[model samples]
Target: MRILAISHLFPDLKEKRYGIFVARQLSEIHRLGAEISVIVPRVWCPGLLRHTERWKNYDHKCPLCRFEGIEAFSMPYLRLPGNFYNRWSGLAAFRAMKSKALELHKSRKFDVIYATDFFPDGDAAARLAKYLKLPAACLSIGVDVNITAHSSGIIYRHFIKTAKALDGTLACGQSVADRIKAVTGKSPLCVYGVLDLEEFSPAPDKIPARKELSLPPDKTIALYAGYLTKRKGVYELVEAIYRVQKKCQDLLLVMCGAGPEETALRRLIREKGMEHTVHMAGEIEPERMNKWMQASDLFVLASNTEGMPNVVMEAMACGLPVVATAVGGLPGAIGDCDGAILVQPENVDNLEKAIVKVINDNQLRADMRIAARKRAEEQFGVKRNAILILNYLRKIVEEKKAKQKG
Candidate 1:
């Protein structure tokens, strides 16, 4: 099967870790004998900011780029901040890439159009497919459906319309699939994100990993790896860490990833006097994440919502116990994952208690560590899940072809 996957979610020259999951998934699908091409839409910025060093990295080289040997392109589209005019952004994305989409279609004759996220990515994908007369499938990663459904407006209606119009929809978790049903009255294929077990496996010795990263080998470290946004509940994490520090001085809270909430998180850490206790490592490359996970004793995600967070699973694959909020598809994803713990969403008191428990109990930690790795190997194998998606996409392509002939 040949697919033209369009989204702004794929990794670019700037943020290599942005949508590494999507990149990994497509690579696995390629290994399964599927041909995939990508068109990552870059959010257009003004001239002043566009020429800056940081913005330069954000800019993708037009025409062609390569991700894991898969052919990919970057298209620029006008976007209004805060996602206010998302519908407009979808139109902008389609208009920007319409010619290129046609050019690729004329040459390779794609069987279907695939999108990473629903709102703009899927919206644009659906439009492109409609224009080129091909089937379209969208992956409903948590936020694209859930966060938009909170209000009933043009954006919400547009999101529903996009989902309904798609030829197929897939979700990272059941909760996200359910939310898609609630909004668009359509069911989506539910599956977890892919993880490279080989890359993320637990280190044979934690002390050596710690030594490589220069992390304190003696201290109990709880790692948080993901975007630093309000939605991620990083503020709540700092608050819980403040309380945890009062109780256990030797414990450390390390946050990784960069986002809009960086300044706010830094201010909160300083205000709470968690200078030494809480550390922000900023953004680390995806290749180096395994060492960071191995260097830590456990993982914590105080997210307000998520589909099935890749970080949680990656940490589990590294044999670190996870303490995350019970929201979105997390409950289902964490199902029987022994080292994973769930606390109420946005509840700092509960989050604090859970973190304290995981850190203080040594025997429990060891058991959880072993259980976590075992769970990942047994349940979340990347190659296996990638084949599932590939088969489903192929099925859709065949069904579309059959209907056309009929």
Candidate 2:
């Protein structure tokens, strides 16, 4: 089957951290023998913020050669951030990608149009599919609905219309799906297992895995792969690390993301003389994630709110224990897993206690690692989830074909 997916959020070569989950899902769908073409947008950034990796566009090279098997393209567009964008963002995306999408459609007719987020991408997808005379579907993994659309009326208005227009929709977790249903009055398929089991499995050897990532084999690495902001409880995590390190000298916190609070974090690290203890591994590609996940003793995230985070699942798949805040879909995802520990968000003492507890127990860590890998495969492996996604896409295609015949 041929599928054309459009999104503004995705990882290109340089911007590996842009949307790692989006890349993983598309890659798996391609692996399942679907011919896929992807179109993404690169929005204008001010010169001041352009220096930051977060704001820099993943420069387009050869779109055809971007990934292993999929055809990828990047379109440029001007989008003023905030309220101004709600009305025109969808139209802007459709205009930027229209010509390229049409040209690609002629060469290989797409069975369906797929979108990642609802508002802008769904808006673009709904309009483009209508224009091209094709069926369209979309998937939202939480944030776009619960956070962005919830906060802004324009974004909410656009996605609500798109949601009503689309033939089908999928959501990562049920809480967000329910919210989407409430807002748009259209329920979505609640889907999970969005990571490749093979890519994220346990390392054959920890020393070699640590060596590959330049992580010290002697230390206990606690990997945190999310935004570096107070809202994410990064400050609480740092303080917890400091307190835990006095008792456990081998503990190392490797933060694998970037955010607004980075400058403050650096200052805090300096003030606490934790420059060596806390290593900042600015956002990295999902491809390199297996190495980071396997080399670490445990995965940690202290987010104030989240859906089922891709990181926790990836870490579990890599056979690592997890210590995370008991917020959002986390409680449902890993709260009961033997290798995982859930603590209250913004609680430094509790976070420290859990870290020290998990770090000190060698047998517990080893057992948890095994259980974590088993649970991940049984629950969240891509083999199960990707097939579900492919099947749903196939259903969309079949439905479209039937409609045409009728």
C-alpha RMSD of each candidate structure in angstroms: 2.4, 3.0
Write model 1 residue lDDT over 1-406, tens digit each, in one string. Answer: 8889897877765677878888888888888888888888887776677577445444544333256648888888877655677767788899999999999999998998989887678989989988999999999788777775444588887887888888889988888888787766767788885899999999888899888888888888999999998889998998899999888889988898999788978887788778899889989988899999999999999999887889988999999999999887888878557788899988999999998998888898899999999888876778978888888888888888898899
- Stretches of candidate 1 above 4 Å error? 49-65, 149-151, 183-186
Q: Give candidate 2 regions above 4 Å deviation.
A: 45-65, 184-186, 283-285, 400-406
Clashing pairs in 2: none
lDDT of each: 0.85, 0.81
Cα lDDT for residue 354, candidate 1: 90
Q: Could you give candidate 2's per-residue lDDT for residues 332-379 as a string of tens digits?
A: 667778979999998898999999988999999899999899888887
Worst 10 contiguous positions by lDDT, candidate 2: 56-65
lDDT of 2 at 101: 91
Estimate the lDDT of model 1. Answer: 0.85
